[model samples]
Target: MQQLRTPHVVVVMGVAGTGKTTIGPLLAARLGVPYAEGDDFHPQANIDKMSAGVPLDDADRWPWLDAIGAWAHGRAGLGGVVSSSALKRSYRDRLRAAAPGVVFVHLTGDRALIEDRMSHRQGHFMPTALLDSQFATLQPLQPDEAGVAVDVTGSPEEITARAVQALDALSRPAK
Candidate 1:
């Protein structure tokens, strides 16, 4: 097993519909850490693009990722929870650059389930039409990354439990 880092900034990451928003605060509350919403970090321009059903390109995402990263950096050592799609390695790397010893909780599920959830969600800027683009852009957590991948097949509470369990395991001192 990898030697995990101490006190974490946990990022509940996945494509838009994987329940980052739903699970982030719950997980934070469970962990007793402060919660930060990734979507709130987006500037109006990015929100407008996604709201219009246009998939964001790399150039469009860097600043937004950097903003999220800034928040993560600020929470380093302090520990907290924040949610981001973090759909690519490059984006995750940008986050890592700003925040040392950051860990991620990647929520994953199949297409049908994700689309169903996305379709029913209300008042979100991201349109269902752009989910395909999000999956296309997704890069799951790699072996070297400090994180765990939890499937989204269960209820949000169950998923949050899984995340908390996994994070607890990672934080335990080696025997």
Candidate 2:
């Protein structure tokens, strides 16, 4: 395996149930780096609001996003992987601005599969009822964004492999 550089930041982003938590740690291990669960950065109020089945407005999300961005920025070359429900293009932009050259791995799956996963999962603040609003807020990442899109429908091992492969490719020396 090619030795991976500390990427500054790696954003494992997607809507709910996209396996950011499941896959991010393995990716971090593969890269020989630290990882952060982006959910940990959310304020208690945001969690309470989501648990109550209320969707947050952009005003509600901006600060939380900024906080996660700040955490990513703090690591610099030490590198870190962060799992987040970065459901909008603007959110990704803000995060990228906070830490330049941040690589985003977007985990995506069909609505039915995602909804089923969300419905069955436990202990998360995000309720199944609020999924539609999240989808509504999501803007697909542009080509210019330094990122990769992975389907979350497969096994955790498979997802981790794909993510590592993508990161490896990005870290490769061009011939």
Collision pairs in model 1: none
Which digits, one per residue and each the tens of the lDDT, describe model 1 over residues 1-175? 3445766798889998999999999999998889999999888998999999898899988988898889988888888999999989888889989896788899999999999999999999999899888888999989888889999998989999998888888778779
Model 2 C-alpha lDDT versus the unseen true structure: 0.83
What TM-scores do the predictions have? 0.95, 0.91
In angstroms, how far off is 170's CA in candidate 2? 2.7
Off by over 4 Å in 2: 1-6, 173-175
* Clashing residue pairs for model 2: none
> What is the per-residue lDDT of model 2 for residues 81-145, given as tens digits with 9 covering 90 to 100?
99888888889888978877678888988999989988888887788999888888888767777
TM-score (C-alpha, index-matched) for candidate 2: 0.91
Off by over 4 Å in 1: 173-175
